[model samples]
Target chain A: MSAIATPLAREPVLSLRGVNKRFGAVQALTDVHIDVAAGEVVALVGDNGAGKSTLVKVIAGVYQPDSGDIRFSGINVTVGGPGEAQALGIATVFQDLALCDNLDVVANLFLGREDLAGGLLNEVKMEKEAWRLLRTLSAKIPSVRIPIAALSGGQRQTVAIARSLVGDPKVVMLDEPTAALGVAQTAEVLNMIERLREHGLGVILISHNMADVQAVADRIVVLRLGRNAAEFRVEEATTDQLVAAITGASDNVVAARAERRRTDGAEAQLEEGNSDG
Target chain B: MADTEQTHTVADDLADERLIRVQGLSGLVHMTWNRLRSGELGSLPVVVGLVVISILFYAMEPRFLSSRSLVSITQFAAPIGIIALGIVLVLLLGQIDLSVGSVSGLAAAGMAVLVVRHGYSELVGIMAALTVGLLIGAVYAVLHNRLGVPSFVFSLAGLLGFQGLLLYVLGRQGTINLPSGSFLVEFTRFKFVTGLTSYVLVLAVVAVFLATQLWGIRTRTRAGLSAPGQGAVLIKVGLLAVGLLVLTWYVNLDRGWSYLWLFFVFLVVVMDLLLRRTRWGRHVFAVGGNEEAARRSGVKVGRIYFTVFASCSMLAAVGGLLAAGLQTSVSQASGTTDTNLTAIAAAVIGGTSLFGGRGSAYSAMLGIIVLQAIQSGLNMVGVDSSVRFMVTGGVLLLAVAIDSVSRRARSSSGRG
Candidate 1:
């Protein structure tokens, strides 16, 4: 719970204000503002190179923001590195998942923070914990002992998401988790995200799939050309509005196609009426 | 609520109906067969190679299977096997240390010079040599981490430079004989754990293995996970006990098993434990499997590289010292010629993948035996060193080819 009084009614579990990041001549991110309250899923939708990844990296401590403030539970903190970010209860599952394919699921889940008993890895304990974690997420991994390479893409996604929860983080960020997954797998991931929210975690989901975002997110935050374009509650946000925000123009390809189809349908109707007369 | 409760019940079993459940010895056999089909070969190919070689050699020259010949093979294998053990570490990282042979020669040469020429105690000389190994590894790490030099290029450079250093360290003498009375000479050349002591050692190994297996079973059962049957554990332990006893009896017919061989096995076992049972070991495999992923997961990739290189060089140094002690001398020729290739070959033939992240310490043990057995067999069949060299090279090529093929199979089978 947040201790300090703020301008807002209830303090968000994670909040970013006016964040900016520059990579040499390219301003990767500019004036980005985001807030994720506990039990909320905030979908970050953007086109390629739209600073969605850059923002996630900044929060994950892979990159430092040139300017802006990050407040975690009303406390200002600097995440020096990935380890520091984890220590701060901010866990991120990168797009690549960052898993060792040669290792088993249990090993991947407890890679850096292995439980040791008498200076040796306690396999039983780790396996038990892995089972418990997967159960919580409702992951359908057959066996935790199987190497990650043997698992399906959906299973791998489950393992990655499960790994994030190993730290018991207040915030979980997933970058394009369903980008390389199948339809069923993507559905599984969306369900996993819902489970993450139900567990009262503030989730930041970065995805390009409008359907996935609309299905899982409590709110949608659109980024276009490294800047925040628009924000809307999922209940009220239409696909067209979200797409326009993502493409940064109402006359983008998708909109143009739809507009052309509408006109074509009207012309067809007019021709049918003329023929009947 | 009913659906959720049903899912909870499924969770309690730790496996969904969709998962194939293997139970008992039959299940184990079936699973192994599936794994083989999927190209998760493990040490199967190497073990088969060993058996085939033994039968072929025994057919060509009955003397090759004699107790005396076996004893000699074990002795000759230990030094290079120890070096190969280090190479296994580097290989696990999907990196090679070309300088291992040179490092061994240089370290041994340095030790001999210190002990014989500089009038240093044998212990001091040994420690100094190992220190040189550690220092060389650290320097290589700096070049790799800070300068971004690839492991092969710098190690290749070390290969020539250290060999020259070895020759220079030997100076005008070109060779230095280890004193006959020194502990290093005695341990490497003459010591043995024979008679009752050897049997006790075998019993100890079997006992420890059984205890660990039983412990695992108890803990797994308590955690509600499927445990391997007690019958399976007993069968494994029984087989191991019989094999060790037979080997010991055979070796006893000769001058008995050399302490040097024992030492090498001890190192292998210790290394295997470290690689499989410790955090450092886990990180090593992770770094080898995918360096980028390891880095993203917060693994200290640089440090892991450093430690593996350092340990590899140090093990090479140990191998060098043992070789020196066994021969009772260090010469300019020591650790030269095919030494590096031989060590690397031993690792590969032992079923360690050249691609890294898929090997173990036991690979060194098994690989060296295959090699030395070949050498002994070739000699018994009256083949020259020339034939030996070609045969060894051919075997190495075969091993690498198998590795490549299996890797492809693994990927295709979704087990890569």
Candidate 2:
């Protein structure tokens, strides 16, 4: 039991410092610094092109940072591809999830890493393990034998999460985990993330839903114009303050008011054009 | 109050136990029905098509369903069926292998040159043929995987290249007849039992294999593993039994039965096991489903592509060898256009989804039978060869269109 760290107060499990990524002429990410401690959930929020995806891609090994360094477990690491990241116990569940819906839940969970015995796939072992994993996450489905196509969006998300944990990954990054789920399903997925944190795994969550971030995120890192704008502890910030920080108007009340005035002016012009037409 | 409490406790216990029993039972039933409805149970359309064709052929000529005709059909279907099995794998991965017909021709030519011209042993000739097929397949796979070429183009090139090689090998010798020998005559010509008995033997083998598979699945489920529902298993076995029984009955109608069809079925089963039970097989499925995802998952995607191409070529070679054995001769005109088109059509018609990641070897066998039946039926009805080609082409188009449409629907529904 001592071998497993508690879900609080630990060294940074993964840290990215001064990371920058440029694609051709445009810089997708700039000077991004984020750290996820053991058992901590870090929510990364930004506008449409705020580099949320680029940042996650860098950590997931989809893109290599042109500058800055990545440190995992206090050791500087070079991640060439997703495989390398996986080897380092970093699992990223993208929006697509990369699951074969034609296959049953167990088959999807053990897609490439099926258990083998006597030179044959040990279906029994794989099935049992799948069951155990689901049980641990407290994912309730009718049966684990059903194809993923038959599952709801929430269940499918659960399956993807289970697949990521198959190798017992240290860092689990989920992109819009509840974006397609209903109210109940969103709650279920949030609960699962809480459970993952309780197990002492560092979680990086990318979401547009402020409510979700406030509910689950321990630390909220706001990105504005491809750079870190502000970092807030959930207890120290209100919804208005977070929104202000994201919109780049947290420091000046007059600027925030002016920006609102400009938005209203644009809306009035659109309405005037509609009436004239 | 104590009596009331005891009654309440008893009711609660009964309800709990009943719920467990009911869940288990419903799970089994639900799974079985699902399997039955899915194309996994062997598409009903294919089965009905075969039956309808058989009846029509029988009506045209009473002897068409006789023992001799049945034997002939099996012998014809054997080589084609073997090739179709390989096509099934390619199809399951959502690809095509157009080189099989030419690969088969090249293999037969190679075998003939080795054994008859080079004065090599029959075993050496067969080995040479198989090796050549495998090498050709490997090259195609590499080109597709490493170079990122579509399988269709890679195999199309193989088709042309191998066919040219076959013509080159034959040279001035337009035909080569295999020498009649004990091994050749016994294995190719001998019948283990007469008429109905032979069909029974074939059916028995199929039943045993299916039973073993079902038992294995059950044990996995009982061990708390995630296995397809018992209902699905039963439905699968039931469909297989019905199919084999019908085929046997048809062949047994005549007093003579050929073991050639059984051999073809065996080949299909072996290929199925290779794809389902082996690491190589899983890799092929993965590569087909999403090559990028599979590569990210640490699979040697390039190697799998290469291996699958090689396997298809090898199967093509085996088909050619069997065809030569049945005819006792390899001719210049052997393995014409029908060979390639029919094999692809058979795989698609048999329920090997053109979209990949969801098909079986048995589908190939069903597809082959359907195509052959169409050819044979049309000929018996006095339809010209030209018209037959057009009909087959149309059917192939329809099958492909349906497959693609269904795949799109499934994906859009967020099922895939």
Candidate 3:
């Protein structure tokens, strides 16, 4: 139990510092610093082209940061590519999910790291493991043998998420998981994220849906214009404050107005309490 | 699409026959119809097409169904089928090998030059020919994998260049007859499994099939997974056993079944297992289905490409040897005329997707048989070669059309 550091109360599983990525004429990311603690859900929210995807891609090792230090479990590490990132116990679920639609769920789940018995795919074992993974996530897949083409978007999402767990990845990053899901499906995904957190794994959720982010995230980190704008405890942050941090500058009018209203309301409540006393 | 349909649980979609479960024969029909509506044709179109073509050809020429004719068809389909097997592998990776024909031709020419012109033994000549195949594939792999050249361009260049090599090997003489008593000629022309051997082989295949299928049922049932019914498995196996026995009986009537035919079947079975049961097979499909996804999964993309190209070229060399043996001569035209396209055509016609990531080894077996049937039927009917080509082109188009339509149906049916 001591060996497994709970993501919520333990040291950060991953830390990024001064990460910058430049693509020819455009600077995709600049000095992006992020910390994802074990057993914690970190929701990363940003506007379109606010370098959210770029930052995530950098961490996933899809793109190398121009100059940055990435530390995993307090040790500085270099994630040269997705494979290396995977080896470092970092799993990424990109926007596309990167699934082979032609393959069955079991095959897709055990695609690269297949358990072999006597030089052949141990199909029985793979299928059993797939079921176990999905069962843990409460994924509503009908059968493991059916091709991905037969599954719905929500089911596919769950399958992809389940696939990420095959190698016991410590850090799971999900990009826009609930973007296209319906009400029930969204709830299901949110529930899965909570389950992942309970397993002592650190979760980095990238989503546009504030309601979703607000529901599952323990901490909200806002990015604007390729840089970290604000970080807040989910318990302390309001919708307006989070939105304001996501949309523009630190001193945005909407957030200021929301703050004034909050202070005035608190003052009025204090005066009423004095009269009652 | 309608939200109600879009919201179907994947369990309901399994009714479309993507994977067999319950409902017996009616369930099977319902599944096939549903799959067709959704455009997930699998190999149904080609299977039905083969049956229809055979019936139509047999009606036109009774001789088309003769034991001798059937045996001949198997022999003819064997070389092309073997080449098509390699084609299916490459096609699964969404790649093509246009140089297969030229590589094969060069091999035959090399074999002839060594055995006839240079007084080399048959074993040495055969080794040299196969080595040529391996080298060609390795070269193709290097150019495509290391240099980042697309396989299409690399193999196309191979088509023209290897033809030059083939011509060079046969310089001053356009043709050379394989010696009558030599191993290459004798084995290709004369070798056949005895009637008893065919019976034994059929029984063994049936026994293996039944045992494996039953074993699977036991495992799945014990694991509490939704296993395909044992009755369905037994029936399928039973029918397969009958088919094999009948095929053996027919071939045995005319000087027994050729070892070449048996050899081809053996390759199919081995390859089938490799693709379905082995890690290498899984990698191939993954690389074919989504290259980026597979790479991210830690599959070595470059090595897979290299090995596949090399294997395809090696198979092409084997096909070339078959062609030389069948004709009893190695000539400039040994592997050139229609060989490149035809091998690929057979694979597509058999139901291997040209777009990749969805096919089986049996596809080559079924595909070559269809093409061979068409050719054999037309030849017996005295159809002109020009007209035959047109008809062949039409059938290929029809097969492609069915595939496209079925795929569209699948996506629209919310199966995507």
Off by over 4 Å in 1: A1-9, A265-277, B1-14
- Using DockQ as the measure, name the better of candidate 1 and candidate 2: 1
Q: For candidate 2, give the docking quality class from DockQ.
A: acceptable
lDDT of 1 by residue, B58-109 (tens): 9988999899998999999999999999999999999989999999999999
**Each model's lDDT:** 0.90, 0.78, 0.85
Error of 3 at A183 (Å): 3.1
lDDT of 2 by residue, A58-109 (tens): 9999899999999999999988888889989999998878777667787778
Clashing pairs in 2: A127-B226, B32-B231, B32-B232, B67-B254, B92-B357, B94-B356, B137-B310
- Interface RMSD of the candidates, in order: 1.5, 6.0, 4.7
lDDT: the better of candidates 2 and 3: 3
lDDT of 2 by residue, B1-416 (tens): 34235433342112212223334667767755654444334466678767877887788877666666666666677788888887887776778888899888889888988888889998999899999988887777777767878888877887787788888999897899888872443566665355557657767876896788787877764663434556767777788778767766665665345566767877887877877877777777776777766766677877776667777788888888888877788877667667887888888888888877777888888888778777766776788999889978877787777666666666555445
Score residue B49 of candidate 2 by CA lDDT. Answer: 69
Kindly report, for each predicted structure in the order presented, the TM-score of its chain A compared with the true chain A: 0.92, 0.87, 0.86
Best by DockQ: 1
How many steric overlaps does candidate 3 have? 8
